[model samples]
Structures are given as structure tokens and as C-alpha cells.
Target chain A: MWGDKLSEGIMSIKEQLQNRFDELTRAEKQLTQLLLQNYPASGLGSITDLAKRSRVSTPTVARLVQKLGYTGFPQFQSVLRAEVGAELSNPIDKYNKWAEHAPDEHILNRFADSVSKNVRQTFSRLQTEEFDEVCALLANTDHRLTIVGGRISRSLADYMFTHMQVIRPRVTHMTSNSNAWPHYLLDMNKDDILVIFDVRRYENDLRRLAEMAHERGVKIILFTDQWGSPISKIAAHKFSCHIEVPSAWDSSIVPMLILEALIAKCKKRIGIKPGAGLTHWQACLTVRAYSESSLRAFSG
Target chain B: MWGDKLSEGIMSIKEQLQNRFDELTRAEKQLTQLLLQNYPASGLGSITDLAKRSRVSTPTVARLVQKLGYTGFPQFQSVLRAEVGAELSNPIDKYNKWAEHAPDEHILNRFADSVSKNVRQTFSRLQTEEFDEVCALLANTDHRLTIVGGRISRSLADYMFTHMQVIRPRVTHMTSNSNAWPHYLLDMNKDDILVIFDVRRYENDLRRLAEMAHERGVKIILFTDQWGSPISKIAAHKFSCHIEVPSAWDSSIVPMLILEALIAKCKKRIGIKPGAGLTHWQACLTVRAYSESSLRAFSG
Candidate 1:
């Protein structure tokens, strides 16, 4: 019990300063600002030097420290110094525990860093409104959905199509054979959603498909990269994520996040279960869905 | 220039204290220790209260504050207050710019948080050596690989199978139908590798498959969750990740990261292109691989 309190009691001096700044006197606030300006460097000096630097009297300085629960300048400096040490610890020390057999800059680490960064940057740049609007379209079971992916993104398209097929009806996954694409286009009605995953070295075939889909008044959601694919001009909703990583291949990390988020949201919107919506053919597909994600529901 | 310097100049006060702890006087150290013990709360009071709490003279406290470049206690407290405010800011505010159409509890933010946490936690727990060992097995062209996944995991299995086929010579993706298992087993050689994805509500057929594979001297690699599937006892390599999220379904976010990382690593290992390894059938398949992730290679 006592140990818990002791552990809980420890917070950094920076947090203390920030939390209690409102209680500071005018001179103290001025002094605090100066200290914060250079952080540890500003505070690593003697009392006389500090007072001189902040243009405050020695007594005033002493009074402020007492107010902050410090015995004197030495104690505060000690804590500040310790914090800086922790902050400056080598970044490599972290990797020591990461991947033992692989050296620094291994594909594992490189890809991890790039993928993590891409997820973060893309999320930061994503607008919630756009995501919500897309989810709303996905929830509308009145309209069918057609999914397609260029060379590499085929697996991703397949992934979405598989999961969506279980959660809702009226979804078709286009095969890699472009020859059969026209048949898919023929069935896509107005306001139907066509989700295309097309990344760089953008395929001419995909561009043409997008053009035809757009002409049919289909609401197209194009998942591309930071550069924004040419299809973006025609896409009703465009998710431009950062997909670059150190490896020869571009990452699908960010785009996949968005895709899953959409699936999850739509599943929420369309509150109906796979078992409830089942046809005999669909039942065969439904049995393969494991129990974890097996709960089928549509919020709409 | 000037703006950059100002940004660089700002370091946290916690960092300041921890890094320069050696410079403190005994009285100041005692007072600083007390302040840190309760953090912001310890320093929020008046000079008399804080000095008494720390059992230090007012002059000693003032001197310490000056030493930290604060004009007085008030100044130090002001900055501390601001930090607390920032720390305590409602997390929803950050999401305001996220999915505006959805409420705070929307699936987007919930899944995002859960997925991000799962990714970070799983990576932290993953052994780099284990990862390298898995990569070594994958890099070995002498061994053919057979991939399988349970209901929901089939897409992931398909994902790995699709990419692996493009990267290596002999790889087979089993369909969801259990009746086809024996046919695949008959083709499996003693040294062939089997990759299985089995999560909660672990299937009986997959366990039987792993058993048959194990009996045949086929190496097994399993991707599971923290609870670990029963297959771990029989499988040679197991990747157990955290899959829980706020939603009803389990997340594949962490497992997918590991999968992609493995693909990136193996691609580096194989050192061969689809074009170079192309048989007539493979050439047809190669035509679809767009530019990114298009460079196929095996390092080993």
C-alpha cells in the first residue's frame, strides 16, 4: 500500500510546472518562461547565475523555489538533470531488444518503422467526415458493391470482399482477368459502390475501369497513395494514404487500416447477421468464418 | 532559422531535472525530491506551505528556483500548470478532426485505438530471433510451402499464398473445403512447410491437418493469438499476437503486420524476380503484379 503511493507520487518537474503555472507570481512566471526556453540548459546553473539570467533578485528566486516545494536550487537541478539523461538515452539501445539476428536497418526494422510512420501520418491526415460518408454509402444495402484491386492490391480487395460477403449481401469481387470486367460493369447500377485499390505505376486497365464505372454513376472509392492516383479525379471518395516503406514494395499498411475501419463501421451500420441473411450458397461461405469475427450484423 | 531555434530551444522541464540532477545542493535536492514525489500537487501551494512540506528554508527554495532560471516559484508553477492542462485535455478533442460524422465512440476511433495498441504490444512481445528463424525457413527454396487459414483467416492465408507464389517456385493455398485436405496432404513431402492461421473457437479440421502434417515430418508454422491455439504444441513455429478490440470481432491487425514483415523479409531473401523465374503459367500471373512490390527476389 505504501509502495503504491510512493510510485504514484513521482511525476516529472515539467508536469508540476505546467499544472501549477496559474499560481505563479508575475516575476516567477517570467523566470519559469526563461527556464523553459532553454529547458535543462537554462536551469543547470547556480542560483546567482539563474537569478541574473532571469533578471530577478536572489531573495525573489529563493521565495519561488520554496513555493514550488523545493529546499533550494541544488535539489531542483538534480531532478532536471536526471530527466535529461533519460531523454537522451541512445535510440540503438531500444533496438537491442527488437530483432537479435538481424542487424540495424534490417528489413524487419525498416519496414516496421516505415509502416508505423505511414499508419500514423495517414491517420493524422484523414478527415473523419470523409470516412463517415464512405461508411454511410457502405451501409446502404439497397446498392450493390463491386470490389477490384490492381496487381498487388488484389489480395486486399479479396480480403475486403471475403469479409464483406459474410457481413452483408450484394457484394461482388472481380477476378484478375480484365476480360470479364465488362460483365461486372454491366451489372453495376447507379449509386452502387466500386472500391478500387490502385497504387503507383497506376495500371491503364484500372484507369479505364474507373472511367467506365464513373460513367455508370457508380460511387467510386479509390484507395491510392500520397501522390493521389489519376483515378482520384473520377473517384467519388479518395483515400490518399502514405504507403512508402524501405522495401522494394510499397506498403498497404495505411490503406488496409482504412479498409478495416470501413468494414467495421459498415458492420456496425448494417446490424444484420450472416446467418440471418443466408441463402444456401451463402451458407456454405458462412461456415468458413471463424468464431472471432463470425458475428454477422448490419447496422442499417 | 529563428523559428527552428525557438522550437529546438524548448525541452521539457522533466528532462531538465533528470539530466542535471548532479548539480543540486543537499537542501535543494531534498526539496526537489519532495516536489517530485507528489509532482504538480506538491508544488501547487504557497511558498510557506511548500517550504514547510519539503522541510526547507524559503531562501533555499528560492535559490533552487533561481538556479533553474525561474525568477521565482510562481514562474515555475505556471509552466507546470500548462503542461498538466495539455496532458489532461480530452482525447476526443484530437478525434474532432478525425471522423466528424461519427460520434466519439464510433468504430473508427475504437478500432483504431485497439488495432494500434495490439500492433505495438505484439511487436514488443515478439522475439526478433524467432522472426529471423521463421524467415530462414521461408528463405529455403528447397522446401515447398503450403498455407492454410481458418474461416476468417482464409483471406490472410490467401494473402500470403498469393504473394508467396509470386515470389517463390512452389507454394499452394488450400481452399476452405475440408474434404480437399487429404489431396493436399498426399502432395506434401517430408520437408515441406505448412503455415496455419487458427484463432479462437479453434477448428477441429485444422488441428487434424496439423496432426497429419506433423506425422508426415512436415514443418509447421502457426499464427495465433495471446491465448495461443492448441496447435502450438504440435507446430514448430508459432506467432501468437493480441487480437482483442472493442468491437465484437477479433482484430487481425497485429498478425497482418507480422505477415507483411515476413513477406518483406522473404522477398529480400529469395533474390529472384517473377520474370526471371517465369514459366508460361507464371508469366501470365506476372502480368498482373503492378510496379510496387513488383520486384520479386529471394535472399537465400
Candidate 2:
């Protein structure tokens, strides 16, 4: 029970500091600064040495340790060591025991929290002026919106493009017709919006397309991580959001949130509202009714 | 906001009753019982009739309203009306604004709470004796394990079955050879384990397979939302859980938790401890090297 309480204390400290590191006291801030800056060395060092290096008094270090919610210095060090170990793990590795220790609630909370952060970040980064411009571009009759993304990112792009296409009728998704992507890009009017998702540095194809689109005077909205990424450099409008999760796993939260926001924005602007009180099941039935004739014709 | 808060208050009452319904006095219990027995009606009714019908006196009824954390009977009735209206809307509808309302810490807490609840409920429902029986069945040399699902459910099942296949080297997933499913089902031995996931009941294939497997004396393990459903009735072992989601929308917390628990249990029994002295990166690289190659091969 003591150990559990101590762990909770330290965990709470880690959490609070994580959220409010900027608001900590000078000594605590100094220690946190040292921990954040020279995390490797400080994380490895003993309490005395950490105190000496961070330029805080030994008791200050101890107090900072307590403030971080650890019973003393040792527990904090152990947690720091584990975190370093996690960070040093390969990016492609599947997280194993992380979820094992986490209850469903914890995973749900983390997932929800992470998703909320992604959504909030996306929402904040989305300027109202830019959003209006994009909406206006889509609202135009002559130009078509071109979306580019592949793999999991493709799924999101496709979903957004499809939903928008139902209302806009001219949104062209690249992956849906990959062979014609270049043609679609080339044929797009200068006023057309090029919506590209190039999360992580992995998708060079997307980055190249965004560059080409930008060069051709197409307005590009690039959803990529970090400011210095290649895609951000060429795109006319860059929306930064984190998709490379710390746990070395794909997160649906970012894409799902982004798509929902985009849909919300589009629906709000264009007066589209899921066919105006049509039940989801009724919509499905309509889809089936239309598709069934074609399917039967083809089969017959 | 007032309507939302009022309904939230009633929800809190329902939650409290859910926790301690068995301990209420006869009159109080009767009121609680009426509310529970006919939630739809109570959710729609005015305070006077609801109280009178439940056999609780006026003061007692007022106290019940107060106990539920409302301002008064009228406030409580307003909440109940809202709840009933909400229920009438659709039970499975996606909460698009669920994240919008949840800020950073709260989102994390709610997600954590959901995950914890799912895990606890899953664990609670899990029988150690059944687990032993399952282990024995799997450990039996004669039994071939067959698993199947589609779309997102398929992805999760494939994840679990693939891991099990790697360690056990005998289990067959339906996705392995789609053509072979019916043939394999027809040839099912009495010792075979047919694990079926019928989340949302989207597919009839799983139910059909389970029934055929059962008729042939094959051991069945079914994970589904409700008891006495098609898959559940045919299974030797039935695990019940609620997805509580709308049509064709697969985002769920409970199903994934159950999948993880099953894998953890099996992996633990198989004695697949984290290979000794492996750095996190090394373990990741080990898994990645193989998974990436397989992913490439599958894609190709």
C-alpha cells in the first residue's frame, strides 16, 4: 500500500509537471529544465550528482522530487530510467506491456486525451480566415478539390473526400484513382484546393505532390508533423499536428478528429447535414437501392 | 446547458442506483425498481404520476429527487424528459461532440475510466475454470483453432490469431485462405476451437459457421454483444459485451480490451516472457523485421 501510494504520488507529479511544467517554482523549474534538457545524463545520474548539475540545493532536489510526487529521489530516478528505456525503443516496435499495465480505462483515457489534444491542436491551428478561403474554394463550381494520401492516411483522406464529394460533387481523391492522380493535379484550376496529408517523414510521394501542386499555383493544405518537415516548406497552408505517437503505434484519433472537423466545417459552410434528418439506416437503404440495380445489371 | 446538466444529474442517479440498487428500503427500492424496470417510461413521465405509480409518498418522492442531486422534483422530471428524448434519438449514435466537451485532463480521465471499466467487467465475467478448459482445449494436439471476422473486427481477430499462430504454429485464420473456410468448417473435428467475433452482428457468415461447427461437436468460443444471440447459442463458451454503438460504425473500447486480455492470457500461459535482457529497441527490431517482411509479402 505504501509503495502504491508512493507510486501514485510520483505518477501524479509526473502528470502535473507534464501539464504545468512552465508554472513550477524556480528551483522546481530549474530541476525540470535540467531533466528536460539533459534528460539522458540527469536521468542516469544519482540524486546528489543531479542536484550538483542542475545547480539546485540537495534538499531542493529532494523537494522537487517530492513535488514530482515521488516519496523521495529513488522512485523518480526509476521512473526516469523506464521512460528513457521506452524512448530508446525502436519506432517500428509493437508496444507490449504498456497496455498490459494499463487498464481499459487507462487506455481509453489516454486514447481520448490524445485524440482531444490532436483535435484541439488541429482546431487551433485552423485559422478562420484560411478555413473560409478553403470553403470558398470548394464552393466554387469550376474547380475540383484534389486529396492526396496513402495507406492509413489514405483511409482518412478518402473518407473526407467522399463525404465532401457527396456535397461538392467535384472533389477528387488521388488514391481512389492513383493512375490519374498526376492528371488530376495537372488539370486542377489555380483556384482549386490541394488537400494533402503527409504525416511523418515516411511518405516522400505525398511531399513531392504537394511541392508540384504548390509550384503550379494550386493552394495546398498540408497536414504534416512539425514545422521543418519537407511538406510544410512547399505547401501554401500548413497545419501542424502530431500523429507519430510516443508508443510506436498508429493513432486513428488524429485522422478521425481531423475528418470530423473538416466535415463539420464543410457542413456548416455548405448547408449539408447528412441529408437533413435522414436516418443512417435509411441512407444505407437508399445506397443499396441505387447500387442494387447496377449490381444486378452487371451480374445478369 | 441547463437541459444537459439536468439529464446529467439523472444519469448520476442512475449510476448510483446501478452501484447500490440492492440496498434501498422497500419504498425507495420500489421507486428505484420502477425506474429500472421501465426506464423508458420513467424517463418520459412527470414526477407526480411516476412517484404515485412507484408507491412512494410525495415527501419520499421529493427526497428521491433530491437524492439524485437535482434542485427539486421539477428539475428531476426535466432531466428524465431529456433522457427519454435522448433515448428516442438513437442508442448507438456516435457522440461527435464527446471530445469537444472533454478537455485535456478530463479526456484522459474519462478514457482511463472507460478502459478500467471494460477491463474490470471483462475480468469479472472471465471464469478461471473456463480459462483452464480453454487452455486444455488449445493445448490438445487434436484441436485446430479457426477464427473469422470482417472489416475492423477482422483486423483485431487477425491480430490475435496471427500472434497465436506464430507462437502455436497451428491455428488457422479465415483470412489466410478465404476459399478454404467452408471446407474447413465442414471438416471441423470435435476437438477444434472455432473462435467467432460477431460484434454488431454485421455478418451472418460467423453465425452460420459457429452453428455448423457446433453441430459437428467442435468447441466454440464466441465474443458477442448480447446473450442468446445466434453466435452465443451455438458456442460452448460465450463471452458477452456491449459495443453500444450505431450502425456500421466500429469504433469501440470494450471489444479491443477483450481481444487484448485474451491474447495476454494465452501469451502468459504459453510462457512467452519478454525474452531476457533484450533492450526495448532490440525487441522492437526483432518483431519489426518479421512483421514488415510479412506485411510487404501480403501487400505484394
Best TM-score among the predictions, by candidate number: 1
lDDT of all predictions: 0.72, 0.54
Model 1 Cα shift for residue A277 (angstroms): 9.8
DockQ-derived CAPRI band for the predicted complex in model 1: incorrect
User: What lDDT tens digits, residue by residue, belong to model 1 across residues B1-300?
Assistant: 575335423755565565557899889888888877756545645678779988999988888877877788777766665554444322222333234444557666666666655665455446677888999898787899999998778878888887788667788898877767778887786789999999876877788888878988999999988666779888888887778887557777678778888987887776553445454335645564543231111101
lDDT of 1 at B87: 41
lDDT of 1 by residue, A12-82 (tens): 66545544544677688667656654454566556687889999987777787677778876677666656
TM-scores of chain A, one for each prediction: 0.61, 0.53
State residue B26's C-alpha deviation in candidate 2, in Å. 26
lDDT of 2 at B8: 53
Please give, for residues A208-292, the per-residue lDDT of candidate 2 as tens digits.
Answer: 5666677778888766664435877677766565554323334544444444444545554555334457643355456644432
Candidate 1's C-alpha runs over 4 A off are: A1-104, A272-300, B1-106, B272-300
